[model samples]
Target: MPAADLTRAALSAARVWLVGGGKMGGALLTGWLDHGVAPDNVTVIDPGLDQGPHGVRLAADPAAPLAEGPAPDVLLLAVKPQVMDSVLPAYRALGGGPTVVLSVAAGRLIAGFETAFGPGTPVVRSIPNTPAAVHRGMTVACANGHVTDTARATCEALLGAVGDIAWVTDEALIDAVTAVSGSGPAYVFWLTECMTQAGIDGGLPADLAARIARATVCGAGALMDASPEDPATLRRNVTSPNGTTAAALEVLMQESGGLGPLMSRAVAAATQRSQDLAG
Candidate 1:
């Protein structure tokens, strides 16, 4: 079998325990099912979620019964960072050995899981954005020393089901990654909002402004994804020497008080916040 097929087959056979079934968790569940993971082999635990997809077991809480079955092959943590501390203890018993713990919670570190689940636990700390709901997300992951190659593949397969995946040896880089792709979708959404408002201020109808702004952002993102050329090249391709795009680019590309420096500052702030949360 091809490697991708083999990975999906392995994922299908693995018992996956999804610890939170909110938006991100739900997205991952959909991805997993689409990638051939058996619904019967997956379990979702969330007090807020009254029901889950058909054939998948759902639990209101991590009751004693949850620990009754064979240890899960993969324990995916998708809870918010604010509540992860309290949630981690409840599932501590599920860690270690064959069961790799994959976390999507922003700013939660592998050491925290290792400490909560035991030092021997294999923990993969990852940052994924909301775009995963549409299978266009970008995720960056770093694994602890205990994660075996096989366990890493399982984690990779699960993440790949949603979107693109990249691995890094330096866990510190994850904070930067979190600042970039993890929080990038929000920036794009804000850009759309700004464009919409700008159009309205420039005399366009409110509804039309919103429609065009939304379409432009979405379409540009799609174009970038489908293009072989780098973003800079694609950008330059549309910018005539003295045209409208160039006029805008002159301001945005300015060394001081420009989009580039502003974006750098924003990313730096986010990176710092990520580091703070990890503490």
Candidate 2:
């Protein structure tokens, strides 16, 4: 078997301990199970969580003795950034060993995890969007120096179960990644809202406008995903030289007062906020 296949097989049989059974965590758990990771090999630790998927053990406290068994191969942290500091200490015993700590919390830096888990611990900090619930999200991640090639492959396989994954050697790029892919889904939703409102104003009924707007946005995204052509090429293929799209493009493609500048400002603001949160 190929090395990649062997790594995947290992991950499929690997023991996983998921911290925080929130939206993202649940999504990841579902994805992993779907990708062939045994449900019996996974444990979810969340105080507020009532239950987990069938065959998956649930623990309310990370520090408490586990009726399940020993430490996991991968300890994935999905808690909110606000509660991460308080929650991290409980899992300190699970770290700095064979376990690789993969975190999906925004604004939490790799350095902080190293400080909490010790310098030799392998840590992967990632930012993933909400779309992972449906398994179409984009995730960008970075790892500390302790992570080995095998550990990186394991992280990639786990992350790949949800959606696409990208890595950055320089961890600082994660702030920008958070701004673009992390917050980008909200921007797309807002665009759908704007399109719906505009359609309503242009004589369509509110419900009709909303439905069409939502469908158009989703359809366009699907096309972008399926097409071999670049987005610019696909966009140009739809737009005529002197047509409705061109007319709209005239306003939107303006040098200064256009979507380009507006989106740049938005991304910049989000990037700054990400940095501030990390601090």
Top-lDDT candidate index: 1
Give the Cα lDDT of each candidate: 0.90, 0.89
**TM-score against truth, every candidate:** 0.97, 0.96
lDDT for each residue of candidate 1 in 158-222, tens digit (9 for 90 to 100): 99889999999999999999999999988999999999999999999999999999999999988
lDDT of 2 by residue, 151-174 (tens): 888888888888999999999999
Reference-based lDDT, residue 121, model 2:
95
**Local error of candidate 1 at residue 135 (angstroms):** 1.1
Q: In candidate 1, which residue ranges exceed 4 Å CA deviation?
A: none
Estimate candidate 1's alpha-carbon lDDT, on a 0 to 1 scale. 0.90
Model 2 regions lying over 4 Å from their true place: 2-7, 65-68
Model 1: pairs clashing at backbone N, Cα or C within 3 Å: none
What TM-score, to 2 decimals, does candidate 2 have?
A: 0.96
